[model samples]
Target chain A: MTERTMTKADLVTSILLIVFSAAVFLISASMPTMAEQNRNPLAAPGIVPGFIGVVLFLLGLAMLIRSVRRGAPAFFAQDRGKPSEVDRSSWGRIALTVGLCLLYALLLGRVWFPLLTFLFVFVFVTAFEYDRKAPAAGQWKVPLFAAILAACTAASVYLVFQYLFLVNLP
Target chain B: MFEGLQLFGQAIVSTFTLRALFDALWSTQLGIIIGMLPGLTATMGVALLTTLTFHMAPNNAILILICMYIGAIYGGSRSAILLNIPGTPANAATTVDGYPLALQGKAGKAIGIATTGSFLGSIIGMLAMVVFTPLIGSVALSFQSFEFVWFSIFGIIICGNLTAPKDPLKGWIAGFLGLFVAMIGMEGIHAYVRFSFGSTNLSGGISLIPAMVGAFGFAEIISVMRVERYEVVKTKIDRVFPKLSEVFRYWKTIIRSGIIGTFIGAIPGVGEDIAAWVSYDVAKRGAKPEEREKFGKGSIEGLLASETGNNACVPGAIIPVLTLAIPGSAPAAVLLGAMLIHGVRPGPLIMIEFPTFIYEVVAMVLLATFMMFILGLSMVRPLVKVLQVPRQKLMPVIFILCVVGSFALQARLFDVGVMMVFGILGYTLREMDYPMAPLVLGIILGDILDKNLRRALILSDGNLAPFFTRPICLALFLLTMFIVLSRAKWFRALLAKIFRKNATA
Candidate 1:
């Protein structure tokens, strides 16, 4: 990221952290001190987290000051209407990967382990390898190869984890 | 000394069995392959394998993990030389000189030197581990709750300071965040759930393995897939061995880098990447004028310094793990977790409970060093093929492992979700230039801090004097303060002004 972008990010992140830390501190303060149990107040569970919350708040404040000193507020205003350098394709790919992973995670216990793994791998590989410029007939090889790899991966992983390692896969 | 030698001998003899040899061979080979592949880091490999090897004997499992650790660090130099990409972060320094040499049609020579340097570096670090661990372990036995609180805080502070040199505030924030993450479940001393928020999984706390596999393994997958592909530079390799005289020419460099590497590795939470960079900087400064000019342009000394330093750091990183239960590096942290899983508690009491275990680790390093040297040089051609496998096909398979590895620990789907959460968080943090090392170290050290601080407070009736007055605690406290103060601009300017006045006087 460019210096301007990083400074802007720092500005935004610091605010979020400050709010988060404040929440943590307040929540920790509300936790029980266990005075009825005759526990040492010094050994109260909330002390460390509260300390951490205060430290985080200070760190966030420091970051906020640093970013402001670097002109993050001005950068935010001056950078408006500029074209973003963000890579949309990369973001798209990441979204696809996350979606597939989430689906796999959600379906893991509900489906057969091997079959689920096979489908996940197949769809992941085929989707990534798909060429939009190519004809549909030419893309058959991509899915075929993905299927083969998916089967091998699913079988080997299943055999290794479930049989050899004796892990009861869900 | 004689007893140590005798135990070392026993360790060597016991570990030399055929089954052990077979395990070492395959695991080291797998480690090398993992290291040669971009995005499959040593930490990830060790974390994933910890789950796979869970059913194995403790000795064998640890042996495999150690072999994997050493082999992977060495293997990263291959991609550094051939593809201009460090297969691991530790090899990032290797690419400066390694790729230049490859461009000069000397890739084979670079690989050979890296392999030999890695071997020698590992040997140096192994020797240091053998000598220092027991001594450190004995000293650590004297530590009380006051000292431990300082130690945990020291680990997080130093790790954050060193790992995020450009902006340490982010590193500290990440570290504190990790410590907070460790606070999510039931408090260790009181059994009070502080931040569970009605979730049973949160009450149980985040499992380190799944969290780690997510942070390093799955995070890496996302980062790797987001980038464009790299083209391998095919070069003809004529020689795979360097002349003895040529290696001897830089004997001083080798020893200096080895020591520097081990020292940096011994520092809690710092790892091989920093070690390599520091060693390279020192080597460049110490080199002759003409040789120094060649530092970034196919200089063998530069390559050797980085490769040796990073490889040496593998053993160096293990020193704190064995002695203090604090990880010296990211991979070492996972290894520490694996040790706990295998019912082998590592800390100061290790000397009393398992005196021979350290020597056995030394022997394991010996075996792994030899295997890495042999496999690194002889199998370069075959291993290059492993790097050629497209990331598109490989990542999905690795993701499968991540899911299963997370689930295999306790057969809980909750861990998988934990992995996903950490993965996304880790990736986002990485994008923001926040170092992950301190964050991870904070998680490992969080329990140590939380439990010990409260214990010390109770012991002292909350006086808070022993925390600053005890000898070790005082030293740690001073050092931590110095580190924090030195980072301030005003403090640095004041130091500079004072030095200028002295010089003028």
Candidate 2:
């Protein structure tokens, strides 16, 4: 099948880039043009960023033109006639994973690292286990095996990084 | 040259200890495992290893890091061949012919060929490093602000051009974005905070290791998770070594790719991924029509070119780091940082100051390549099993590792947060087809570019003429412009017309 024309995502990404470039340009402009430490205006902290801003703006404009010429669809419109399996489930998976990561990050330094890691891995594996093909034995075996594997992973990582390598863990 | 040889001999002696040998073997094995797993890359492998090796002796630590870097780059071909999912970006070209070979039930032979290609490519690169580094170091001594500025720009431009073949503009954009990201901290010239907005954390700027982990590691995890299921190929194993005749037949391709890979690797800020692609493209272009049909369909020559080019790049990427204090790739940048941390400075005066260090690095690379070859051939069966691990189970572990890696760099939770932010950003950018190589290179090169440009201008007393007038500067400027503009439709069309006319005559 032929690829779809520019989708709404392309247009949105281009516009976001344009806005980002403009923001960088403004921030660069606000930096000290001539510093007391150096007499040359060319040595200003803002010079390179200013140039990068201009390049980014031009690039964003190019992207905008290309996306427009290719016929951008609406923001919420689907790219294909029917949504595929990934299209239907990817968002939920992403959100759930992100949420798990957020919790892990929050708990990283507060609790014992190995313990926190074990819990995080356990939850993550359990959540993803349902999606895998079932073993021939029984449904209960999946979570039990996942928990054991998660514990081993966490303990191994802790031992390797903390004891062997002496990397101070958070 | 005599001094270099003396130092090389000393380096070989230093690395002969049982402890050193064990470090090299263990690190290389770990590197290969990381490289064979989907969602992990050579850059991340080196970065993570750097933190862990902080306490070892400089020689041992550096040996392990070098081994890991080489092994990881070589190891990536396994998954690329077996599952069509490149363990690292550098292996993407391998997937073209390698996966096809696996589908034809020659996976063992493909892996064996890849191993030989990596060994020969690395041998060539190591030889080049030994011979050319002193010469480059001497030449680089004269490189001033103008040359450095142009060099950094040239790196970014060429990298963007190579990575995003279809749309270089997007590549350039991603690169500049990375430069902007680098600008969000205290300026080196005056120590004046530019974009910190009074936040103490922002003043130190974003950490490179964390940002890189986010871009390549976490970003990969997110991308891999987005795909629900991937097609897996099953194949029977035969011999794990290619015939001597097969190796001899492809000697020309291997040598050509080695030369190309080393040359590209010597260029600052470029990496193995581009080397592989460029070598593959050149090989494809030069192939006879009948032989060309075998390309992308299990051609041994195509796989050899790609594997050789990328493997050679590991040592090529080290040339600038040792001679010029400039990194040839993202991993090289991290290696540069690690060297500084280990109190070994790599620059023009390295021969004068730390004369034996370069030779030590050369020895390390040589040892690493041998280890990689041995491990690659022997561990082929077990390593291929990594491809069978379900992505669902593998990704979360990868994600947790990303978290630990980012935090382990400086013991900063904020860096972990930075990784998360970049992970989301990288995922979005990847979805939109923007390449990540230039972005990472831009970040790595930003400070060098910024400092050199201003320094050149200041030295010239606000005159911009020297930037374009100096011989090296002029050449670099023209080369960068040529590479950037050569991708334009008009330029290609015009070149095509000229070539067609010449053919007709």
**Best candidate according to DockQ:** 1
Interface RMSD of each: 0.9, 2.1
Q: Record all residue pairs in model 1 with backbone atoms less than 3 Å apart, i.e. clashing.
A: none
lDDT of 2 by residue, B148-241 (tens): 8888788778777767777788788888888888888888987768788888888889877788888877777776776677766778877998
Q: Could you tell me the lDDT of residue A91 within candidate 1?
A: 89
lDDT of 2 by residue, A1-170 (tens): 02343345567778998998898889888888675655677788888888889889988898788777677754235555755534557887777777888788888789998889888888887887764566646678768878887898899889988888677888
Q: TM-score (0 to 1) for chain A, all models?
A: 0.93, 0.80
Docking class of 2: medium
**Model 1, TM vs. native:** 0.98
- Candidate that would win on lDDT: 1
| Residue B202 miss distance in model 2 (angstroms) | 0.8
lDDT of 1 by residue, B1-505 (tens): 7888898999999988898888899999999999999899999999999988998899999999999999899989999999999999999999999999999999999999999899999999999988898889999999999998898888889999999998988989999998999889998888999788999889999888999999999999999998868898978876988887778799999999999999999998899999999999999999999999999999999999999999889999999999899999999999999999998899989999999998998899899999888888796777778878999999999999999999998999999999999999999999999999998898889899899988999899989899999999999999999899899989999999999999999
Please write out the lDDT profile of model 1 over residues A1-170, one tens digit for every residue: 88879999999999999999999999999988887799888988899999999999999999999999999999989989998988899989888888898899999989999999999999999999999888898778999999999999999999988878888899
The reply for model 1, stretches above 4 Å from the true place, is: none
